[model samples]
Target: MTEIESATTPAAAHRRPASLRDWLAPPIPGSALWGWLGPLFVTLFAGFLRFDRLGVPKAVVFDETYYAKDAWALLKFGWEHKTVKDADSLLIRDGSDAKIWEDGASFVAHPPGGKWMIAIGEAIFGATPFGWRFTAALAGTLSVLILCRVARRMTGSTLLGCAAGLLLAVDGLAFVTSRTALLDVFVMFWVLAGFACLLIDRDRSRRALAEKVEDGVGGSLGPFVMHWWRVAAGVCLGLACAVKWSGIFFIAAFGIMVVLWDAGARRAARVRNPYAGAIGLDALPSFVSLVVVGLLTYLATWAGWIFKPGGWGRGEVAGNPLLRPLEAMPDLWRHHKDILDFHNGLTTAHTYQSWPWDWPILRRPVAFFYTEPRDDCAAARCSREILGIGTPAFWWGATIALIVLVGVWLVRRDWRAGAILLGFMAGWLPWFVPAFGDRTMFLFYATPMLPFMALAVALALGLLIGPARQATVHLARHAPSANRRLLGSAVAGAYLLMVLVNFAYFYPVLAAKIIPYEDWDARIWFNSWI
Candidate 1:
């Protein structure tokens, strides 16, 4: 029987598998074709949304002015270099110029990983708006695909997986970040990838534990699985950290999550003293896989600065006699320290700055771009904008869905619910620490938490939709539970429709399409949004 089929009741979900084969079987077996077809269709839709008018307004929006030039400088010098004054206007006018930089490397605060991603697009498309944003768009597109697959694995339902992807596709914040020249999308991609890898590792490790309860390769110690997937997860997480320092939170949260999953797998496999077994067998390798490997991978992303010449701090560290022996390693450490200091001291006021507490609810969204275009629309006045805000219907619904997932996790011991909560909290809650110091923050930083919010919504929908086969037969269709499921399917479908309508209403501003001033004013739903 499928996992959901076996789960006839909430209590049934907690039951141990009947046999070793049952323990090793796929959860909620689904048609192989729908698995591929559903997610890809949703991904195509997401790609269309992200790529549509990706280069609109023709002006560099918000941080693109910094990142596009940084990418061009990185392409030219293998590291960021200082640009000439009025470079934004110069680049916008003649973006293909290679001589925008002066001598000496620029002291970039963030790591080079995200810039490298931007540099790829610039290499092919030149330093244009389309070029810098190509990576973000591509990453966002793949994020939909990845989230679809992850949800499928978690819920064992293709339709629910597609729903999750569609939610992300319609999310205003995700859509905006994906179409802009920004680092958050890249970091979000890596974080999701790392989590996906660990998820696969969870299944594989469980299968390894199912290899013979009493005697296998490790003999009662839960036979050794290479855990290369976990290692790959580490590499992805490390790459995420390289993209943004905020990515470190996932490394910590996911580390604990994986270890606990290992312990749970042992318990489900009926291993003696499962907690002890996890500590002895799973803990050390997990540390190596997640921590040591992640640290090494993060450091490796600095290859250009380590090997190539003319990077900032290389000359400074190499010149100091006391630190010269260690090369620029000291300078790299000092550079990180300086970056930390800058972040800690960042309390200056800004018009668009938002509190972390308000991010999920989106009380204030950063206005990435805005222009009162002369004669741009049918109306006497028009507003062209790229507002960095999320869809209200989706975000508000997800708030309740997330709360429901928390309750489901506590009441039913659903691992999927707990995992989603952990991912969301890791990306979101850390900002509160900095918030206490009155640190300046923006809504775009909430990008990494969005995928998990989408997942929580999908999981709740899965509960509503129930197993695909439950309502397939006549007697099943007439059953009491079937009636509830029918109602749920209607609700789920209606919610999705609501999400689509909400997205359509806000599409003009989200895509930077010129709109009537009255229409744009209507979209500014809150006073804080203006």
Candidate 2:
């Protein structure tokens, strides 16, 4: 065999299994107790932020007019239904669930999964704002935990993982979404969960392959490794899809991500024909585990509507191709198409509609709730507002970190960096599609990508700290290791503190805290923000 070809081929991989065992071992670092503790601390902080005065504004804010009511309907009725006029005022005025629903069925734009989640809160809290938003807050808080754990696993640093969680917790956009009845936070939660599951799968699958090598199984195609974690990831992605169609992008992105990750793992282990082994041994299993399983889970989320038979679409045993719901009703496919059509043409000029490009910059964040209340403040002009803007420090830092990650991934061939970027792309890049760009979009649509952005920043911090692995990437006669480590630590610490301070300064606007109009105006930061 040619020298280069032999080196590259899996057949030559039979040389020895010693290197593969050490190379494919887990990267998770530190004690299990500390790891759990650090992430849990951040999660508690996230919970506090999300749960504090969740019912504040005490009124239906922005899209809450739809989602909150839909949740109530879903809890009481089996599906979404029309509400009487002035239902918001009536419901808020008396905190009563009486006389809200109209006789007609409501056509919802999104799937019932999110509303069902909201319904869990309403069911517990009796249809009040706090009740309806409860599950969203919980989901948002749990997302912090998931991100922390996932980041820890990826970077093998509990400190960095906690930093990622804290970043997500303190971000104003995440805070506001959690406190209000919104679907984006739930979408973010499921997406983060799916990514976390996949990360675990990656480590486990790689380690299993290493074990196979240690057993002297060579000169053969890659083994069929069990992927329970991957199936769990599929379920998470499916739940994401059930929450919003946008999750389908992650399904596609992550599906491809895992396959590539597997191929790379096999290649690193010097398997014979790594690509073929991955393709032949892994692809079909992945399809069944992630795709088929995910589809089934997504379909299962519609069980409430399916069994009730009063859903917007869905007729007796499915009949005409495109008939109206009032007539020989259509099947789930046509029903779903109606939703797709609504979203495709949803370009009605909303005052707060933002372009996809504006999201990363935090331009034109939607004001979920705003009021110049008559009392309950020290200042003459008091304003209470919940503006859904991200922490500028984290978002902007992450923006730069993404650029840095491209270099890091190319230079180091680090899968973690690539994984972070892939996640951000799966959640954010699809919004730039020309067809969807024409439709009205909002900054909160970027919520599902927040954890990835946080991960990017955390991963950057770890690299900055010049850990041994990173240091080995660039060898120098005298790299001034101590000075560089100190400097890197200082910079990372400063950046995190800046984000924390920024989050505190904007707390009033984020949490609907009543403050002097001038104070709220100062937090706006720019005219575009207003």
| TM-score of candidate 2 relative to the true fold | 0.91
lDDT of 2 by residue, 1-530 (tens): 11011112233334432466655763455789999999999999889888888888788889889998888888776778889878898767765777887776789999888898998988887778888889999999999999999888777778888999999999988888888888999889998998888988888888898888667675567666888898998998888998899999999999899999889888887687888888888889998888899988987777656655566765343254333333422467787999999988888888888987888889899988899988878888999888999999999999998888999889766778899999999988888884355888889999998999999999888778765322232323223366776888799999999999999999988888899998888887788877
Clashes of 2: 3
User: What is the TM-score of each predicted model, taking all chains together?
Assistant: 0.94, 0.91
- Candidate number of the best TM-score: 1
**Whole-model lDDT per candidate:** 0.84, 0.82
RMSD of each: 3.2, 5.4
Runs of candidate 2 with Cα error greater than 4 angstroms are 1-19, 93-95, 315-330, 435-437, 468-480
Residue 317 alpha-carbon offset, candidate 2, angstroms: 6.7
Tell how far residue 12 is off in model 2, in angstroms: 20
Cα displacement (angstroms), candidate 2, residue 292, comes to 1.1
Off by over 4 Å in 1: 1-3, 6-18, 214-220, 316-326, 468-480
RMSD of 2: 5.4
